[model samples]
Target: MAKNILIVCTSWDKLGDTKEPTGCWAEEVIAPYYIWKKHGYNVTIASVKGGEVPMDEASLNPPYLTKEVEDFLLDDEAMKGLMDSVPLSDVKGDDYDAVFLPGGHGTCWDFPDNAELIALLSHFVDYNKVISAVCHGPMGLVNVKGTDGQPLVAGKKVTCFSDAEEVAVAKENVVPFMLETRLKELGALYECGPEKWAPFALRDCNLVTGQNPASSARVADLVVDALTWK
Candidate 1:
């Protein structure tokens, strides 16, 4: 049977109080969505809210745009799926083989404190299922508890949008908190590649994470490998 992968995205569309538009990073979700499809896995897109999930404007143009992202935007089926993402409340973690979260600055606003998201991730951890995220996406994992009643990321090797990268993008003060620092505060053994904006992914057991938009594909590939081992 083909594995079912649940992809969670952010519904928050505005930057913190600035009213500037920000949502799911196009490449973050597009890259992984295609990778999963290439491996013949079923993908379900979901968000904090049930309706259309927004994309960060920054991710749709110039330096952030990639061939894969461009193709995804033009594909009717893919666009339809994203536009009609199922609400997180409507989906159960047990229905999927694994779960992946794609990051954007928007995630920093919604993913960290969402009870449904935390519960969904908890189910995966409790069941020993693969859970993966990239960049700010790991914000979704911040509140997830392990079987031991501790943060799922605690004592686990993990990586996410780093503080330096946040500064590089000049979002250090705009985001709610520094993701790498927050992960570290949660007892995660966090680390990232030496160079900024380079593709970097890490897997500690069933938990997989990537460092930035560029790392999404590797994170997706690692998720596939994790599922295979199970």
Candidate 2:
């Protein structure tokens, strides 16, 4: 049977108090979505509040947009899925084999400190299900605790959008917190690729993480491998 996978995107569109527009990174979600679909997994899109999930406009511009992202934009069926995402509160861990979070600065505002999301992540961890995140998506994992009551990311090898990458993009001060710093503070043995914006992904057991949008497809491939091997 094909496994069901949940792809959670950020619902928030405003970038902090700056009122700037931002949402899920297009490639981060599109790359993984296509990869999982190509591998015969049933993928579902969801967001914190459900309904239309915005894409970070910056990610759609030249230099950031990719063929996969452009393809996603032109695919009506895929766009429909994103536009009609289910609410995160309606998502049940038991219904899916894996859950993925794709990042945007918007995620920094909504993914972290979400009690329900944290509990859902804990449930996935307890069941040994795959939990993957890329870029700012790892913010979702920050507050999740394991069965032993420790932060789920504590002592785990992981990676996300790095501080240097944020600085390079000039969003270091705009985002709510530096993702690399927050993950490290949570006790994650966080690692990154040799250079900023490089495609890098790491998997520790059932947990998979990617460093940036460039790493999204790699992260999804790793998730598929882990699910198949398990």
Candidate 3:
């Protein structure tokens, strides 16, 4: 039987400072989706608002876009599902083997504060399954509390969209709170490379995370490894 994996996509387009036309880095969602499918894992997507998921139009073109994305675009039914994804509340914690979050600026808005997301991830962590995310998706880690009532990320080493990357994507003056700084405040031991957009991933027991869109597939691979290793 295929192990079930849930990938969280962003429903919001604009972030705190970014504009609407700028949305999720399509690669973040597509890369992992492609990898997991090839690896024979059952993947489902849930969005914060549960409506149409916005795609970064810019990434839909050229070498920035991979062949897998082109195939997904051609599959009308699959594209429709991606456009109109299920809401988080409709997803049950026990239905999945692990949950993965792909990131973009939109995650800065819809992901960090969703109560349902907090509940889903909290439950996944509680059950000791793999709870993984990349880029801004790690913000989902912000609100989850362990049964002990401590921050789920407390004392865990993690990585997410780095401050430098956000600054590079949207000028330093525009982006909101630095992810590194905020995770640090929650007692998460944050570490990363000297440059932004580097492939950085961490696994704290079953919790896996990657630094940015570039690390999406790697994070998914790690998630699969964790599940099989179990």
Candidate 4:
């Protein structure tokens, strides 16, 4: 059977207190979604709440907007999937071989403390299956506890949207907290690329992570490699 992949997205749409709209970065989800489909994997999109995941408006413009995202905007099937995503509460983690969390500023508001998200990640941990995230997606990993009752990221080699990148984007003060600092606080052996906004991805055992929107395809490729060779 083709491997089943569950993609969890953020439901929150606002950028902190600002009126600026934001959710999953279009490239983050669009790039990886097509990659998984190309590999013949079954992909299901879900969110903290069911239905209508918002794409960060800025991601639709230059720099962040890529061919994959442009294609996604024109694909009715993909649009329907995003518009009618399943609620995380309705998903059973066992049904998937891997779980991927794609990110944007919206994740800062909703991912960290979600009970359903934590429980689903726990299932992936218990089964020793792949758990992957990119950019702000790693925020979902921060609060997850391992079998030893420690933060799941503790001692694991991982990377996410760096603190420097946040400052570069001028959202350092706007986001809830610094992801790099939080990961380190949780004892993650966090790593990043040589510079900000680069394609950086790391696979430490079954835990895979990418640093930014630019690293989405790299993260998906790593997950595919892991699944193929396991």
Clashes of 4: 0
Alpha-carbon lDDT of model 2: 0.92
Which scores greater on lDDT, model 1 or model 4? 4
Task: Rank candidates, TM-score, best first.
Answer: 1, 4, 2, 3
TM-score of each candidate?
Answer: 0.98, 0.97, 0.91, 0.98
- Residue 141 of model 1: what lDDT? 89
Selected candidate, larger TM-score, 2 vs 3 = 2
> Compared with the true structure, what per-residue lDDT tens digits does model 4 show for residues 46-147?
999989998888899997779888899899998887999999989998799999999999999999999899999999999999999999999999889888
lDDT of 3: 0.81
Give every collision pair in model 2.
none
Which digits, one per residue and each the tens of the lDDT, describe model 3 over residues 89-151?
Answer: 799989999998887766777777788898889888789889998887887788788768988
- Per-residue accuracy of model 1 over 118-224 as CA lDDT, tens digit each: 88888898889999999999999888889998988999999999999999999988888899998999999999999999999999989999999999999999998
List residue ranges in candidate 2 displaced over 4 A.
Answer: none
How should the candidates be ordered by lDDT, best one leading? 4, 1, 2, 3
Give the top-scoring candidate (lDDT).
Answer: 4
